[model samples]
Target chain A: MTAKLAERPAGADLVRSGIRAQAANSSFAFVVRAAAVSVFVILVLIVVTMTREAWPAFWHSGLGFVTGTDWSPSADLYGALPFVYGTMVSSLMALVLALPVSIGIALFINEYAPRRLRAPGVYLVDLLAAIPSVVYGLWGVLVLGPFLLPYVQKVADTIGTWPVFSAVFGGPVGLKSMFLAALILTIMIVPIITSITREVFDTVPADQKAAAVALGATRWEMVRGAVFPHSRNGMVAAVLLGLGRAMGETIAVALVIGSTAQITTRIFAPADSMAAVIANTFGESSGVNRAALIGLGVVLFAMTIVVNMAGQFVARRSGRKGAGT
Target chain B: MTVPAALHVPPTEAPPTALATEGLGVYYGDWLAVDDITLQVPRHHITAFIGPSGCGKSTLLRCFNRMNDLIAGARVVGRVTYGDVDLYDDRIDPVQVRRRIGMVFQRPNPFPKSVYDNVAYGLRVHAMTEDLDDRVEDALRRAALWDDVKGALKKSALALSGGQQQRLCIARTIAVEPDIVLMDEPCSALDPIATGRIEDLMQELRRDYTILIVTHNMQQAARASDYAAFLTTEVDGDGDRRRGKLVEFAATNELFTHPQDPRTENYITGRFG
Candidate 1:
């Protein structure tokens, strides 16, 4: 067939070669497109299932289901605000704690590490990101949580004396609290941010850095003046992507977050993130409760999409501005 | 049989001969890149390093500033001194050494910050504070970039053209007021027009600052250098490596007219690289 194609008639040869090239390209494209469509189907299935289950709740209780504060299902009030608050709080806390650490790790790997060690260090950090979120939750619950709560409580009480730390602890100690969840979340996001920030830093032109160093700029000065500026937009996007992961985290957040739907005021208190609430209640819920849980998923999905879009938009604008400069 | 071209300098501004090197050698991970380079770039003159590709010209240029130290496993043997101070001394910080000897790269590499910030970077790093805005402006003027960039002080450095970026780098380097400026093929990546601008800029800069440039463009070396060093490499008998030594050192016109070494004669005449 190959020989025939090679010696094929002129018009037929063009068609054969074109077809062969198209076939090769299309095979790759077909796989990629199939994977994309598979993801689309999965997302659609998830949304449809969630809405099917959550619709009954909206019909039965309306917007009040989201606004209601009473979450004791046994006595029968299931407001989701408290859980939503808990999820938002813990995720934000994780972001706040993880962002700077991630940037530090990334910079350390990119510019600060001794020449021989940089690549290996980055790989080790990325390995941490690959660890399952559940393992993090388990470790947080068994090892880290007990080690942490006292310090957290003490700091809370100390700073709690000040207005900023005023809220009393509301979440569970390990398996049911905002502090544990956030800590686990922080541990998880660190790897993601580190890997991405390092990769972005690598994208900075070596000549650009050389230019700064040539000017009598110190190593720190080169990073502060050149590398950091070039990678800032990318770093921001990386952090936001990590934040989205933190926000949507289910197994880890659920494992540690105390499952409750009540909004409360303490950093160390027990609480529920969106996924945690859904995971905890979905199995037992029928009709309205199931629908409510699915509603929770929809809200989470929308939030994830919003976070991604905003991050991408900021990244694009920053890249343009950097290019313009 | 005959001496290689001795690098020449304008007799008026030649640095004191006492502080220069003898037999400078460089190694990269056990591979000798630059060999048997002996030349003096006296103070206050433009000395250009000219050679074929992979002739260790860049390595030789970087050795003066110890910029090669930044590369891992890059080892240097031989003496580089400033007055009585040995540059490779344990007491000497590469940072401090670099402050005295500045560099400009092949491609224009400006920090991504505003043009003002890019100029200010070196000053702030060295803790040299005396009317920073004035210093920034002075450096820019010295590099001939101030006129174009003055209005856009706050604009990002990345916004500049390739030529402008290279000039910005030169301005940033001089902000520290270094004693020597090293350039490694500074115009290799530029268009002829940009290359011409850099040559003119080099001539103007040589008035107050000493410069060492490595260039493959023999014409550029001929045009801009007050002093020129020619370097090359060879595989010795039994697989030992050796560098091509200086062919002759004389004023640009004299060397081109009467190259003493056969290699130099061939190179200048464009018979071989």
Candidate 2:
């Protein structure tokens, strides 16, 4: 049939080649579509399996799982409030501690760093990201906790007088506490946020930067007028990415967070995160307790999804303004 | 209509030179891009630099406002003077030099901000905030963009058509009320009709501001300038190093009709660049 098509007139040659091309294209597309669909299938399967395993705990606990703090397996009491509190507070604490420093480092690497230092600065930031989270946990336990104790105590002494600060920083500052976990999380997430922010700042149009300078804007003002506004969406997305990482982190947080089932106003107090509690106790847990741990994973997944949706919303809003020369 | 008095300076009594360079050369790291040349830009007149690609016309234009200082490894030798002040003096700030001499780039680069904010950016930067709305209005009117964009002042500057965006850039440049406006191929990215509008705007602008423009289009240099400078690239025998050298500096009509330099005549008559 191939030899006959080649022997045929030019019209048949065109039709034959067209059919052959179409066949190749459809086969390629079919392979690609299958690969793409597998990801969705795996995701759906995970969700279904988790939902099935978690349903019993959900039915037994009702709203109590969210608001209750007790986690005594012997008493058959399972509440998730302390873990939720730890996760939320530690993540927020990390964000608060890391946001300004990350932005400053990003700006320095992009705009203000001396020419010779820029490359090394970026490399050092990447090096920070490459360090294993377990190493960070070890450093938090051995080096950082000892090194920072005196300063943390000083801060606790100075600002502990204020009502708001007292509530957050009051109580015994310990080696393993919500504050320590948040500090460790800051170390882990800063590089992620800074690298993304630097890349976004780099994407600001060169002509726009020149425009601001040509209009007599000072360096800081030029960054404000051009770089920051242009990169705002990407910056938000970067911060949210860091937030997601901080929320899902397991081993480092488990080691530092002290894993307790009490909710307290003091951030210096020991607390438990959902991932930490699951990792620490899941091996020994059975029956409804294991199911409740799986349910906690579901909640963490939902929170990350909400964060990602907010990031997408911000990205789309700024995307409209991205249509520039 | 009044800027805060402390931040405003009355234009100096018509100095013979708005900006002038003596023995000026620019280098990017090891490469010498433009060689020593002296030229004077008369106040309130249009001086156009015409050259082919890689001829360093834009480099020379950037010298007026110290804009070349922004580029890494860029070095300017010799002196550039804005009236009596040497622009490269250690006491002089490039930011201040930029304020006195504004620039418009080849592409339309409005901030990702509202049209009003784009025009107001320079004002707010220099702290010339009093009656800022009137200043923005005056600038837009002067650039002949007010009517087209007045209704959409709050709209993002990036939302405008290319021509409108370019005009908005012009308004932003002029809003600072600089003494000299350096345009580096401002109309290169525009259609002929848009180019024509900019040419008309340039003529109107020249009545008040000293305008120095670098353009690749010979006709644009001839049609829109009072004086023209022609530059061409000189390659070494090894072809390793190329530098842009000025061939002719004369009144537009004289340079075009009469051949002071054979190279200028060839370039003007389409024989070579």
Candidate 3:
């Protein structure tokens, strides 16, 4: 037994195995680090490639590309202001129209709905999101647009007489118009906003809600006092996410926005969005026009990043505040 | 310390009853959580409910202001009355009942709002907005949080310490001038010093509000409460599940020094829960 123990490897063998274990650990770390770094690498690559593709348009239009409104392709005037305005107005309007309805739906599902109905209600809302954007666009153009055109026209004629309303509701209501595009966008984003808002509302601590209720707050008052204040940042984040979705929606807005390049205050008038313009004109464009479309894509990408970053900031701040409490 | 046998005689005059439950039983769906319990909460006194875990002490406390109604399947049998009014009556609005009878929870759940706003929330909800500043200050003072937070009224209540937040909750509850304040393990989440501070505040609050507190700590019940009720879990007939039943109810000193039931004695002596 003593001879066998002397022949067996000592510290040298243990050191060799330890070195092997360290190599294995280092290789595992390297794999995970590569995976984590790849996300940043891919994001940077996309930005660089898109910017390079858009360089010619930037050189051709200079600063006037963003500031100028005209977009006559034959004349080489590729001003993107109209598309930007249409995108902003349509997306913001959709958000304005959708936010209240989404909040109401969320509160109804989470707070007021019967226990048995809540799951079905949530599933139905989620199912709305499952419908394709193209289908929504097709429905918007074929069905809702035509159905609402006459009523919209009538409203424009009557309420359009008011000074402030004239700018918004004015003139000839087209079958495919900004209003139709915005309405479609509203429907598309509602489910996203409602689901997120519902999740945020669910994060409100039960004890805080009880505190409010125990203090004689009516159901509505409890919502206003406890639920609303606690969920403010989360709700903002949800709305911003919905805004990002609305702004980037391509095929749907392209189908219903009539591919017009003009800027108008009238919701009934045909207009074009950044995403819609790219989708519509990309097929036949070349040289600077194509680059200008890609430039628009870059701009939309930047806008989405900004909105999403703001959302992340708010969410993180709320998370920290929640943890502190 | 031994007391004379003659001095142990029960007082003939009982304090006026502020709230009472008659043959009250609480059920969550098919499960009986708390069996039939009948007890009176005397006016302007602190009553503590002591029991082991899963004894439905919290459930019984929630029954006072109808907070149990907020739970999906929670049901209460029999009557809970405040003064002459039945709290569960169809004509009685639970919201109104809550205004008259408020509650503090186990964890200090201050709204993520300004300290002033937290206190003012109740006052604003009840439309008692007149002298809002004074009323808020008065409540904060009553809850023993005024000096600590007076200068920071605009700060978020969440930024306050745990003890301070619980005091803010107490201030918020009493700002509406509720007749009874129900607390469900209000200090169970606090450190010993924080717990002591709350106990001191409770003694001060007992002059105006009839406070009902549920505590797992028998020592807390002995030290802080004027009257005490002991609860224990008992197996239901032919069932494996246990439901909470009241074992003893009496003056705090009497209940601690001389328990009427063997279960209460065993529990107080730390023999078995």
Candidate 4:
């Protein structure tokens, strides 16, 4: 067998096969490289084309396009501040509302749940993410909005009595309101955040967890000592992804956000976000109006990019400080 | 010749028992990992459990601090006692049990925290924060890691070398001033020089703390421990399942030199695992 193996390939034959293998390897490398570069190419194309389409509105309104409040297309007025305000308020509120609940659910599943219940709990939370955003909009309009109206009004009446608190809470409660839209956005983003946090929690080394327990830590203490510091960056990323999801949500916000181009401190008041405004007016919009809608899209894109970059910076900095290299 | 001269000289008197287990059988689901283990661990002495892989030596070591309680579906059907307290009593908190009986893992499992934090973790958790700096320093000093790490207390524990990390883990475990320290193959992941350092440290630590260690290295068990238990796997009836059984427990020198059981003799002679 040794003699046969040694004679299987002569030097000349080995050289030919090596040449063929090298050719195949380079071709495979070329294919994968092309596939990888295509994503960047597509991203650049989208940015260039979108910027070109929105140029007219940028030229027309200049700085006022972002900082000014009015957004009346018929009067040839288009200030994006109202939509920007609505988007920021709704998305940030959603993030604040969803974060704790998502972390709680993740911890419950990963650390506290019984072995039999853990799998089902994860599946159920993931199932929430699988639901269509339109369904969430429908639920917000038909069920959640009406259900929350009384509580929201009670807050407006009670908390609104304080001069400082009255600014954000004092307003007539409506079926289609910023608060209702934000509540729906909260529900929409929770599953994504929870799933990501769960994955991060899983990445914590088992031995590290064992070390904590061996040191006489209670269950919660172990999580705080070992799991939290280890998964800090990942949890930050999860929250940021949820924020991005809440910000770009169109149909859900459009349906429940009251579609009004106005900025108000009262969350119970009707308002419009950037994506909602674009979706609600895009059908009949033409000329400068269409350019203005696309301009809103450009602004939304920039905001998300900035938010993601900020999240990355926070994640990296905290990871270094907390994780200790 | 590497065996210390003191190790060959048996103690003049019997030491008091610090911990004891009776009819101990550990199970994961239905599979019994270790069965009928009854032994008394002497106070302030290093007792080593020597066995091959799958011999449940590590499982038995975990039972000391109730670290097995963390594993899902893992059950202990026996009595483990520290002093007069039944460790498995319903009212006894596993967390508090762990505070009194600490553990070091096979791999050096230091928290992803600064060296200062890693040593202070157990103290902080148990609300023993008074003179925290002194306690951390003392623990590091006891683990023989103070000189190497004192300059880098704020540095991440992970930045240390493998031996330093293991010593740091030792410092973390002893920081709470646990009465007993359980080591599960603490030197298995280390190199020879690091292993020798740990073995020397173990000898120093045995002066104050009761220690139970599970080790695959026979020479380490012989050189470092005062008492030794030799365990081996036995095939269960009507199945291919192998369950760990203790064949002999005796003074370390006696067990290595004149093993009572044929199985122990076989294992010590390198005849079979």
Q: What is the lDDT, from 0 to 100, of the residue B129 in candidate 4?
A: 100
How high is the DockQ of candidate 4?
Answer: 0.74
TM-score, first chain, each model:
0.84, 0.89, 0.91, 0.92
List runs of model 4 lying over 4 Å from the truth: A1-4, A16-34, A309-322, B1-10
In order, the Cα lDDT scores of the candidates are: 0.78, 0.87, 0.91, 0.90
User: What's model 1's lDDT at B50?
Assistant: 74
- Across B1-273, the per-residue lDDT of candidate 3 in tens digits comes to 332221222345789999999999999999998999999988888898998998999999999999999998999998998999888899999999999999999999999889999999999999999999999999999999999999999988888899999999999999999989999999988999999999999989988999999999877887888888999999889789889999889988888888889888888888785
Candidate 1, which segments miss by more than 4 Å at Cα?
A1-12, A15-35, A65-68, A74-76, A156-159, A162-164, A168-176, A312-325, B1-9, B12-19, B240-244
Judging by lDDT, tell me the better candidate of 2 and 3: 3
What does the interface RMSD come to for each candidate? 2.0, 2.8, 2.8, 1.2
Best by DockQ: 4
DockQ of 1: 0.58
Ranking by lDDT: 3, 4, 2, 1
TM-score of chain B of each: 0.91, 0.93, 0.95, 0.96
True contacts kept of 2: 0.73
Residue A88, model 2: lDDT of 86
Tens digits of per-residue lDDT, candidate 1, A1-325, equal 9997778676753444567788999899999999989998998898787777678766766787778776665665557778777877888899999988988887887788887788788778878988988898888788888787787766665666776447564223333477778889999989887887777888888888776666666788778877887888888888788888898999988888877555777766677878988877778977566667788788788788888888787677666645434
Error in Å for residue B114 of model 3: 1.3
Each prediction's Cα RMSD? 4.2, 6.1, 3.7, 2.6
Per-residue accuracy of model 4 over B13-107 as CA lDDT, tens digit each: 87899999999999999999999999988899999999888999999998888988988889998899898888999999999999999999999
lDDT of 3 by residue, A1-325 (tens): 9998899887655554577888999999999999999999999999999999999999999998899999988999989999999999999999999999999999999999998999999999999999999999999999999899889989999988789999989888789999999999999999999998899899898988888999988999999998898888888998899999999999999999988989999999999999998888899999999999999999999999999899888877766666322
